[model samples]
Target: MFSLRTISSLWRTSKTDLIVQCQQQKQRLSSATFTVHPYKLHRIDEGPSTEVTCTRDQAINYYREMTTIRRMEAAANALYKEKAVRGFCHLYTGQEAVAVGIEDAITKKDAIITAYRAHGWTYLRGVSLVGVLAELTGRETGCARGKGGSMHLYCDRFYGGNGIVGAQIPLGAGIALAQKYTNSGEITLALCGDGAANQGQVYEAFNMSALWKLPIIFVVENNGYGMGTSAERASACPLFYTRGDYVPGIWVDGMDVLAVRQATEFLAKMCRDGQGPFVMEASTYRYFGHSVSDPGTSYRTRDEVQEVRRSRDPITMFKENIIQAELVTSDELKQIDVDIRKQVDEAQQKSRTDPELPIEHLYHDVYANMIGNDIRGITPFQRHKHQNTSKPCNITI
Candidate 1:
């Protein structure tokens, strides 16, 4: 008969050995090279091509980022439901691939501007999870200092979560123009939803961008519907990639992270090569409503939503691919999920306890230099002198 202490000692040794072996295997996989399967590009006109290489590190990072966005959006949905977040909260639940893939392909110097569905982009662009959650809850610690709310979050190079539909399109082009003027060699990614694609200003920006040969990549996230109206019912031409007649365009599977990255890389190169602006239509889907207030089911069926979620979820698809390639174990990915959930939970708790922005903040970031005019106070004709003398308040209000 074996002694109990001896048996326990043997079990511990075996467990340690197994753990060490797994770590060694993971390290080996991390250093290994892998090929990303290519997908045909639906090109409006022929352009330069680049091969996308997916490695263990890239897969792991993509998985982590996409999962983080998914979990963060889930937290935002709950916060909105609980009334902790208010005023036009748009969750980026199913469109993680578009943001993550773009960020992966571009450098930090490159700028990005997007519509209200922007939490994922903000996070990927270097905003902390706490900052994003705090912004949503209107806390003083928010990225926008509690003023922008869910519709406005910003980082160093990221422009905003612009509230107005189709507004960011022209604004993005303007940013690209500045980049070109400075000879920064940086490109700008201007993202808009399918609903905003038909706006007149977008075409005008496209024409100006093409004429000036600005470095801008117009990414239209075609998520099927524009609010409650289906894309089929809304636009005469649903293929947004082909909408830019003078500018070259490509259509890609937005659900596939690698595909999105490959397409973005190709488009970004074209812009850098002085080919002017390029258009990419990413065929994605939003799992949640346009906003928290929207039920998102009047025009679409519940089964249709469920089917997309099951078949084409970007996070799930990435996870499956990485696991199948033996780049990472299921347990490793589950651990990442567990860690992200805990991080989000902590951020939510902290945001709840953070103080709200003070009333005087309204007059703080209004101008670059001190203007001699008095801002109107609560009582009409009673004006308060603006005291802020900061140089170049370049922050987008």
Candidate 2:
């Protein structure tokens, strides 16, 4: 019905509008950007190097895992205050990124062992929140059958929450030895604190691991303070990465999840390639004291802790990055926080109701092969005759 000229004009106008729309969409897509924070990696001999990069999925997963750990530690703290969880309780509140990042770089076949601040690692390595909380509360449903408390939670590939400082290092090296003997291509992560780094056993383990070319990664989580003593006061040289004389080492920004992941990935590959042992000193901070008993304010000021929380909190920093990149919304992260809180709360309740380990189980699982052994009773002179039987010993403590 229209003239040819009019039809051409109409077609041209439609095409122009479509082009503008496409350009706008392109602009919107380009506006969303993600950047990883740069970290300096101090090698053993050479100068420090830097690297950073992360995917949207990796960011999201790290956020969730870190959030879960933060909430779980908070629940543990509350339970401890309420006298529900007794004994030595070490809360890994601020150091969540270290465990989460390291676990991300390894597989189920790889093993992990650490000092008492191990609840975070245990949960990340596939133990359920309920199991961890129950273990803290000394319930039978715990990962360690309520025998190993906060300092001794264990799972399939996780060796334990070792009570002795630096003791796990040698054990981790032994595990790596077995891995090499079997040619399983599995590496062991041996985690210790700055305090534990001073122990003689740590150096011995390092020497042995390096000599045997064992697949071990010695992770020193230098969290500033050892118990109440600051690292500056404790060690002459706080640069733990450099402690490995013969073994290669790197120092990373433990506060940055991406940095930890990248560094761990690179080191793990080196071990898998039969490059021998590597050391990583994760310079991190702890929000809580060494243990729940310590107020955490004796040496460090309240302002210092507050400033770290405000500026460098692993969860907060990661959340900001993801939100800024348009990968996720702040509201979505809030929902995740709420869900984690609920999950932790539910775990605490379940742990309270879970049955405590029976006294008769004290001597069970002690020996690989069961044998009739005499166990000391309530009185030193009285010995309890424990028979080698399939059933649990009926004798009560």
Best by lDDT: 1
Residue 371 accuracy (lDDT) in model 2 = 56
Clashing residue pairs, backbone N/CA/C < 3 A, model 2: none
RMSD of 1: 5.4
Q: Write the per-residue lDDT of candidate 1 for residues 282-354, one digit (tens) a residue.
A: 8999988889899999889999999999999888877887787687889999898899999989998888889
Q: What TM-score would each prediction reach against the true structure?
A: 0.88, 0.86
What do the candidate models score in CA lDDT, each in turn? Answer: 0.86, 0.85
Looking at candidate 2, what is the lDDT of residue 130? 95
Displacement of the residue 141 alpha carbon in candidate 2, Å? 0.8
Model 1 alpha-carbon drift over 4 Å, by segment: 1-28, 31-51, 372-381, 385-397
Model 1: weakest 10-residue lDDT segment is 31-40
Please write out the lDDT profile of model 2 over residues 1-397, one tens digit for every residue.
9999999999999999999998886555443334445444444444223545556567678999999999899989999999999898999999999998899999988999999999999999889999999999999889877888899987778888899889999999999999999898889999999999999999999999989999999999999999999999999998888888787888888988877887788889889999869889998999999899999998999999999999999888878876776667788788888988899899999998989977877665654454567777789897765544333432211
